[model samples]
Target: MASLKTTLVAATILVAVAGCAKKRPADLPPPPVDNSGPVDQGGATGPTTGAVVPGSDADFRRSVTSNTVRFGLDQYDIDPEARAILDSQSAWLQRYPNVRITIEGHCDERGTREYNLALGDRRANAAKNYLAARGVSPDRMTVISYGKERPEAMGSDDASWAQNRRAVTIVLS
Candidate 1:
């Protein structure tokens, strides 16, 4: 009887231990890949597992000439300098047709939130239009206005304001 009771307790403990084993959630997605190194100009990413994955946002940004284009204060027009950058971006977008992107418009801190928001919108649209005209599909692009909420450079000077007045292209997928 004593041996049988010991055997039963051992079985119970084995069952409890089995129940406590770690289980991977079936609904969870795989962990994201790290992409901090310099971009490969070739533009392809992910291993050859037969599973296709979109390129990382950072890689896409580095693959292009510039991820951001500067704009004149209170202006949404694409200047010559901005045009060059946009041209490069357009070419990159053409290469990665499946990659969707968002253009974030930003303005300096000199105007009211409402006014700045409108300016930012115009700025984002101007960039989007430029890329669209350069053969990138409009369907792959979206726009948002940040107004003065996000600034690349913080200061009450011309240099800082110039940095803030810009359009930044962000990869979505």
Candidate 2:
């Protein structure tokens, strides 16, 4: 009888343990996470959000021209071309009040890392200020300096370097 009782107790504990086992939801997928550096949505490789779903980044890029403005060598000034782009961007931002963005500043691979980072920061702020002056709320925009870390064009040549020296606006949902 004692043996049977012990067996029943063990069975009850097993059942309890089995009942308490974690059951993961089958319908929901895990949130997106990038192990490498900052999370980038709808990157140069294209949208990674979903197969058919149109991503916010894609939409923003389409609505707003190139989403990028080139800077002169070692310069953070916004030229007439850059000003025109910013004007259009401001109009788009006004249309989508809820959308927030981050202006990424980049530099050519010529200056020291520290100097490039500082220059990149200045470039980012220049773009942000331009937008703010054009009526886009400063609260909706943020600036980040990639410096020469993430270059659009890879090469030591002037053409590639020119491409690298730019500020790009990315949608942050």
Candidate 3:
């Protein structure tokens, strides 16, 4: 009778263990295999997930032109319009893996020298942050603060100041 009880207990434990086995998630799909043609990487694998492949010369040029981001003046905040531009830029960057950009920060001549410098930094960083928010790789973007040094419009008025207080996106070759 004791042997029978022991065998039944063991069987129960085995059944419980089998029942507890993990099941695959219902939402997961099978890996996409490209078996129709030759493998991309010499029978290895294509680019990994979230991996950016280099772009061609034409692609780079298109990225440079299409991903240009502009900014507002006296404020380093990313606005809705700027966000829309950045979103397009992010798509362009993703499409052209070989593209990288530098966000140059500038300030108008209204503020003090040091204040302008800091504000320029803030503007540049803000632009980069916007791009990053839109899925552009942080590694592919750089920031530089010109601080009222390089003015697009050389006038000392509000119009020129507004133009000068800008973040220009430059493409890196």
Q: How would you encode candidate 3's per-residue C-alpha lDDT over 103-133 as one tens digit per residue?
A: 7777887878888889988988988987787
Backbone clashes counted, model 3: 1
Q: Model 2, poorest ten-residue lDDT window?
A: 30-39
By the lDDT metric, which is better: model 2 or model 3? 2
Q: Candidate 3 vs. truth: CA RMSD?
A: 18.0
Model 2: per-residue lDDT, tens digit, 70-140? 99999999999999888888888887888898888989999899999999999999999999998989999
lDDT of each: 0.82, 0.81, 0.67
Off by over 4 Å in 3: 1-73
List, residue by residue over 47-102, the lDDT tens digit for candidate 1: 56423234547566666778888988789999898999999888778878888988
Q: Which stretches of candidate 1 lie over 4 Å from their true place?
A: 1-54
Candidate 2: stretches off by over 4 Å:
1-55
